[model samples]
Target: MLVNIELENAEDFVFIKQLLEKIKGVKSVCVKEEEEFYEDGTPKWFIDKLADYADSLEEKDMISKKDFFKFIDEEICRLNSQK
Candidate 1:
């Protein structure tokens, strides 16, 4: 199967990478570099943090608010402006 995760930090990604090595039926568990989130914020490490939380909350196939908001807000604004 395919397990996608949003890690909270580089360290978390490292942990997942290592864990995957010892697991099975994982197919390919990867953490992709998400686009920047906060439009006018400190550019927090939100995506990494979200991924980290995912690793901790294994078996939960969902994105966390920590990083999802960034992309959502941007998309919303882009759509609204077009309308």
Candidate 2:
């Protein structure tokens, strides 16, 4: 079984985690900090920097989305061929 927990106070995380770990049937405890993301499950930082990335690509004469997709497709095919 797996469980996800959201704590009200960050300071209580360590104490709560230790308490849970002592339970007889508890196999393991993992901690993951919350992250902000878009509805599409994209990280907020990645989405925020996309425009900057696109602008840099455009400066290098790679302005078209079609060109980007084609490049990615070719790379995937090449990698698959190598395998």
Candidate 3:
């Protein structure tokens, strides 16, 4: 049999977990915090934070996509040549 308990407060959850641990046949108790995720499987909060960071970078000085790709390609070529 499986049991599910929901507690709004962290302290209450911890106390109940301890009490449940003493009971026989209660093999394992797992606790997980709920998180929202985007459709692409990325955490929504993290993606929002990344968007904010990118906006900040753009406000200062942003590199062109062409230049960025060129730099990456050159770096990859250089590294491959070293092998």
Deviation (Å) of 74 in candidate 2: 30
Write one digit per residue (lDDT tens) for candidate 1, span 1-31. 5556766677777777888877866566565
1-83 per-residue lDDT for model 3 (tens digits)? 99888787777987898999999989999986777887898998898999998877853486789989999999999999999
Our tally of clashes for model 3 stands at: 0
RMSD of each: 18.0, 6.5, 7.4
lDDT of 2 by residue, 1-83 (tens): 78889988999989988999999899988877687998999988897799788767745574589988999999999999998
Best by lDDT: 3
Score candidate 3 by lDDT.
0.87
Q: What is the C-alpha lDDT of each candidate?
A: 0.73, 0.86, 0.87
Ordered list by lDDT, greatest first: 3, 2, 1
TM-score of each: 0.35, 0.43, 0.55
Clashing pairs in 3: none
Reference-based lDDT, residue 23, model 3: 96
> Where is model 2 poorest over a 10-residue stretch in terms of lDDT?
54-63
